[model samples]
Target: MLVVYTTTLFMISLLIIDYSTYVLEYPHSFKYNMVKNK
Candidate 1:
């Protein structure tokens, strides 16, 4: 039970990290392209 709980938490954290990075990077890439065009 403990192992299962830990694994679930780890998976959740990984997903959250991935989602946050994607959110953070999306605008960054857009701005980068905008700057490149200018």
Candidate 2:
């Protein structure tokens, strides 16, 4: 039971970090595309 709880917490934290990274990277990606167009 403790193992299961710890795994769940780890997965949740991983998901949050993954989403925040994507949010940050997406803007940089968009700017890169805009620059390429010009």
Candidate 3:
């Protein structure tokens, strides 16, 4: 149970890091896409 929790937390952290990097690298594009989707 502990191992599973740790793995899930790690995956979530990786996703957050990746998402932040993407937003930082393409802020305008990300905002544009969000507006378009809405």
Cα TM-score of candidate 3: 0.69
lDDT by residue for model 2 over 13-33, one digit each (tens)?
A: 999999999999999999999
- TM-score, cand. 2: 0.82
How does each model score on TM-score?
0.82, 0.82, 0.69
Q: Report lDDT (CA) for all predictions.
A: 1.00, 1.00, 0.94
lDDT for 34 (candidate 3): 98
Which has the better TM-score: candidate 2, or candidate 3? 2
lDDT of 1: 1.00
Q: Where does candidate 2 stray beyond 4 Å?
A: none
Candidate 2, which ten residues in sequence have the lowest lDDT sum?
Answer: 20-29
Q: What tens digits encode model 3's per-residue C-alpha lDDT throughout 1-38?
A: 99999999999999999999887889888888999999
